[model samples]
Target: MQKKYVTIASFTAALEPGILEETERYLAIIILLAGFKRYRSWRVPIAIYGSALLFGLSHLGNVGWNGETFEATIAQVIGVMGSGFLWAVLYLYSGKLWIPMIFHFLMDYLANLQSGWNSAGWQFNGWATDYISEVLMVLVPLIVTIWMMYGKRREVLEENADRLMNLPVEFNRY
Candidate 1:
C-alpha cells in the first residue's frame, strides 16, 4: 500500500520545491497586505472555526464509501478542525500567510505518514478513492474571507466586526 501510495504521489515530488517557493512568495505579499489590525479581530477566528467544523461534515461521501463509523470519522474531523483552528490563530495573529501555509503542509505531510488521506480536512482518505486525491489538488484559504469581512479593528476585535464593516476606509463614509 505504501509503495503504491508513493508511486502515485511521486509525480508531484519534482514540482514540490518550486511550488513551495512560489507559495511563499505570494504568502509574503498577502501577509503584508493583511496588516496587523486584522489579526486582532475575533471574527477572523470565528470564521476559521466555522470552516473547520463545516469541512468535516462535507465528508459524507467518505463515510459512506469506506464503511467507517461516522463516529470514528467525526473524531478525525474534530482533530482536523482543531488543527485548522490552530492554523487560523497563527495566521491571524502573525498576519503571515506563510506561517499557516507551512503549518498546513507539515500537517498533511505527517497525516500522509499515518494513514494515507482522509476527508476529515481537505480530502477523503487516499486509500478510500481517487476522489480524495483530486480534492487536495486545490488549496483554499478561508481565513482571508474572515479578515475581509471584519476589516480592521485596531482598537478591539473582541466585538468590532459589525462596526468595522460599517466604517469607511478613511473614516469618511461615517
Candidate 2:
C-alpha cells in the first residue's frame, strides 16, 4: 500500500498564485512609465513605496477569493502591505526581479501548504490570533523597510559623493 502524503508537485501546481502572479503584477506596475529607468535618485524611494502600497491594494480582490468577510479582508490587506514592503525592498536592493519572484513563490507555496489550499484566509484562524498575525505582518515589513532603506540611502549617498564633492569621474575598464 502506498502512503498518502504531500509531494513537491503539489507546491508547483499553482503557478498563478505565486511567482508568475507577482511577476505579472509587478511588471504591470513598472512597465507603464518605465518606472525602472525614469524613477531615480530620491524619487526611487517614493516610487518603490508607492508601488508597494498599490501592490497591497491590488490584493484586495483575493479577500473575496478566500471567502473572508469585509473586516477580515481589511486586516488581510493591511497584512499584505507588509509583504509588499518586503518584496519591494528585496527587488530594490538586489536590482533583480527574480529575487522577489522566487521569494514570492516560496511564500505562497508554503502558505497554501500550511492552509491546505482550501482555507487560505485569516478567517481560518481565531479572531485574536488572526488579528495578531495581521498586526505582526504589518510591523515586521515596516521595520525591515526602514532598516533597509536607511542602509540603501547611505549607499546611494556614498556613490553620489564624488559628484556632490565635484570630484573627477573615475572609469574602469571591464
- Highest TM-score model number: 2
Instruction: Give all candidates' CA lDDT scores.
Output: 0.44, 0.59
State the TM-score for model 1.
0.44
List candidate 2 stretches off by more than 4 Å: 1-14, 28-41, 118-120, 124-126, 152-174
lDDT assessment of candidate 1? 0.44
For candidate 1, list the clashing residue pairs, or say none.
117-125, 117-126, 118-123, 118-125, 119-123, 119-124
Native-to-model Cα distance after best TM-score fit, residue 93 in candidate 2, in Å: 0.7
Candidate 2, residue 1: CA error in Å?
22
At residue 145, give the lDDT of candidate 1: 35
* Root-mean-square deviation of every model: 11.0, 6.7
State how far residue 34 of model 2 sits from its true place (Å).
5.5
**lDDT by residue (tens digit), candidate 2, 1-174:** 112324555467444556665675456435422444333344445545666677777757766675776666677667767888788667655656777778877776666666555223556355678778888998888887777656545354223322323434233110
